[model samples]
Target: MKINLFPLLFTIALFYSCINNQSNKNDLTPKPYKVSKNFIPINKAPRIEYNTFNNITQNQYSFTNTTSNQEVSILHHLDETGFHFYQGLKFKDNNLGVIVGGTRLRARITLNGGKNWKEVSFSRFANSFQSVDFSGNNIFIVGASNYIYKSEDFGKNWSVFDTKYFFKENQSRYQKFKYYKVRFLTEKIGFIIGEHERHSVILKTIDRGETWKIIKNNNLPKNEKGISDIAIISADELIITTLSGKCYKSIDGGVNWQLLYSGENTTLSSIAFFNSRTGFIGGSNNVLMYTNDSGKTWKKIHMPYGEISDIVIHENNAFITTSFQALDEAKSFIFKIDSKGTNTPLPFLTKKDDSVFFEANSYAIQTLNNHIYILDKNNLYRTIIN
Candidate 1:
């Protein structure tokens, strides 16, 4: 009657042991979370950039990436090495920078992480050089006079390929016409488009640039249009825009093309397609057209007022850099274009009195490793602290 003390004590001890076991389990379990900076558009300020400049005066930046994201660091800044201009960036075990000199001179700089840079020079092939793009182990740069050079040797020595559509006839000026830009989606397949006689011309290479031929897409009229720039949206699709604001789609590589916009007044300087279905084009007249369905139908993204030279879409966030913003004569600026197509200006790139390179080269804006690059006034600048 007094009580079963031993049995009751045994039950209490068992319960305490189970409670201790559960508490220890809870302590050992890992918690789920993030350490900030993962969020988007969040910034102390925003910036703007240009892609291709007409001249020094035409190549100034008004907007800047003022957002002080710590992870985004400007690894290196070299005014001397960059020289007159630098084009095309390739990131491998190291980051390589290809600089185009004033007189067809070409040099490359390699970076280990964000540390020091190693300069690789090629003084021999320094005549009439242009732009560069990467495909796996192959590094390629093309220049004026139909000079296309490829480096399977990691920028050590380059082999000149026969991109002879321009030089074939061997005319003096037209033969060495400055081929402005080159892009490669893969090592084996790539496309080159540039101005020929002030008109857009398209070139295709099947063997990485060893040999090339014109993309005989006979259907899309106007052989005179100069294809100023092209982007590989996918292996099978491409968004081709020219100086004439002529937007063409080539789903089967460059073999065929179809006009998506007719009579677009402003010249489209740069084109970017995040996916096969989503794309954006920066054109004159402050026009930026976005298409959700590849290039089938496009809707103009009204920027209120800015001459957008290039448009870059990273996930849901879209970035457009303009020559100048009409708002209060705000000057040229780089602002973040959001999902709703609204514009958020970055003070870092657009801040007044902040000097910019690559004048009005509205076609020279590029984003890599979160650092903003503007090739405006025949020079290049990196957003370091900002």
Candidate 2:
């Protein structure tokens, strides 16, 4: 048998030629796969920040990305009072946004990814706005003086919902429910937690704000510190942290609540769940508590910082911001807690912290398009992790 050496050599040569051609087509330096930053720059450069004892005029903000821990971006807002004491921040997308805060009925909206922000004049609401949450196309704002407003068209127009029904027929300070935080699981199902003088109130609306009813639960304590933050895991599972450092868990869509954890002289300012069963409750006096058995029990974690004002989980990492109850800005810090609940303070603030500028006002942290934002009354800092 004569082996066809010529044809076999020809086929081998063709195969090597095809391999070389494909290798040449593939560029060795493939562009790094970039997760979108979705950054929107501020139109005006930031002005000098003014920091008094209790008052802070946040004119500028800068952040250290978690991946590099280097200065990435700085954003500036208005050099006015309405931008002070920011109660809440929510960005609908890379462009449209809303922030509710200030002494007067000061709420503002940004059209171009927070480059320029304009005051949203809500004629019907006259008190300081506290919390804002959006579900689908509906936006809900709740605040001091027992008021809740709903917007159907992304905050263009808002309608006031009658919260007067939460109180008795008689109008009294002890009877009036002062709402603090709100969360909506869907357009129709939502929950708002607040407190009267002696009673903690949880209001539920199943009909998309058309009607709201008080969740009747005799389990809540009297003269409680009130619900400061709430995390809605699903239609049935709900968790709320109180100003008095107590956590309540409700499994039946606010139908009933059980005491998850309680501590004397501890105030929990914020609560967040990494998942349905794991969560953390944080607040003043350097309190940071964790629960893994669906709030059945909680263990206190040792933290060097004084007050844990906010806790936000992104994947396996949990970011927390803290400040001194006293007037020491040096103690203010941000710590990145890993999945094992190990506290490692990120040095993102060491370089930026001047004796005058304070990082203590961090009240909220949010993530959008792989960028994390730390927000307070006067400033918003952006960064990245991993």
Candidate 3:
């Protein structure tokens, strides 16, 4: 009788173990992701035709030009001490553009499409400039130590607004306010996102750049540290990406915010919307996400590079710049993403010497009239997008 009981109990235990094993195996199986019908799946997207310019040397200026072929040609170079780095670039049209940067507060303007650049001088208030934006004849530049430079006559005369008073009434607090990006929705309405003591700060200007006020109830997440970029859909709607990989949307002009996407703890450096309902966000760790339904949902797009520095969308194509440091060397790339979610890599300027000036870590790209203008370190390059 004892022997009979033992055999039966052993049999029952063995059967249950087999069932559990099968269940665990089923749990490990990969499941397919559900994508919206409006969005194209990556595997099913169409491939775009493009060319890469890999052989252009640092000293050698221009690449081979063709209608269908993309060319990377150096337009201008800044070898002076104060103009060794370029932080921001904005083109007013096909013929006029401005670039701002620093070893000290420095900017260069080209009226003939980067053929010639003239130095723009600033008062010795801020040591560096980070970003620039323009609407019509009015140009706004933001930079370190709470400096906001406004030029109503297209960089002819400068009016500086030191926003330290808007933050805290102290000198130390003024130094802590660093403006990273400036965006103007219209000639009169604009937003600036930066940092105050390592926390994200947003400043709003309803009267162009004449005056600014801090957006107090921005409703940013408690853990959000710094803001990487801001995208304005309209005067009332705005989106911002944080250094913590969180994206927030404000429908009521940044008075209140709603969390749209919480990323995988990576730094989202750039965001661009081709339209109100479709956009792309790029970040560290080769993270590139595309959302068709605004920011309600996002899908990962495979990127071959590590940090995405900037994203510019032109004519239904998204151009992305990414850079990564490798063994004391920096490598950069330019990728074109089409409406169908296809990604094509374009050629970028390679380092010809052991100099850091040619390293493409913080380069910027802008497209106008079928030409792509790139600001790389102290040099400016142009490429035709065919």
Residue lDDT tens for model 2, 1-386? 97879999999999999999888866553433321122111111121111112122334445444346666444434334443567576666756666776545456666665666656544333356677777666767776644566667765555565455544444443234567777777878888887766367788878776567778876676677778888889888888888877888888876778888888888888888888788788887777888778877777788776578777788876788775644655534667776556564454444443522444566666667677666654455565555
> What's the C-alpha lDDT at position 238 in model 2?
88
* Model 3, TM vs. native: 0.74
**Residue 160 lDDT, candidate 2, scale 0-100:** 60
Model 2's TM-score against the true structure: 0.74
Better of 2 and 3 by lDDT: 3
Global local distance difference test of model 1: 0.56
Query: lDDT per residue, candidate 1, 1-386, as tens digits?
Result: 68779999999999999999999987776433222211111121111011222111112233333354323234434444333444444454335544443333444444344344444433333354456677677766665544455667665545554444333444332243456668777787788888655655677766766666666666666555667677787656887888777788877877777778754467877787777777677777877777777667777776655577666555666666666523343444555665544344343354333443324333445566555554443344456433
Cα lDDT tens digits for candidate 3, 1-386 = 43568888999999999999989986775433322222222233222111112222235366543333455677766576344578688888877777877745667776676665667645344367778888667778777645566677665555556555554434341247677789888888889998877888888888766677778755676567778798889977888888888888888888899988887868888998877778888888888888988788888898766578888888888888766665654444566778656554443444443443544555578888878877766567777777
Cα displacement (angstroms), candidate 2, residue 148, comes to: 0.5
Which ranges of candidate 1 are over 4 A from the true structure? Answer: 1-65, 68-83, 87-90, 101-108, 113-130, 165-176, 304-306, 323-332, 339-363, 368-386
Ranking by lDDT: 3, 2, 1
Report the candidate with higher lDDT, 1 versus 2: 2
Q: Model 3: residues >4 Å from true position, as ranges?
A: 1-60, 65-68, 79-83, 121-127, 169-174, 326-332, 342-358
For all candidates in order, the CA lDDT equals: 0.56, 0.65, 0.70
Local lDDT at 125 for model 3:
42
Using lDDT, give the best candidate's number.
3
Error of 1 at 152 (Å): 2.7
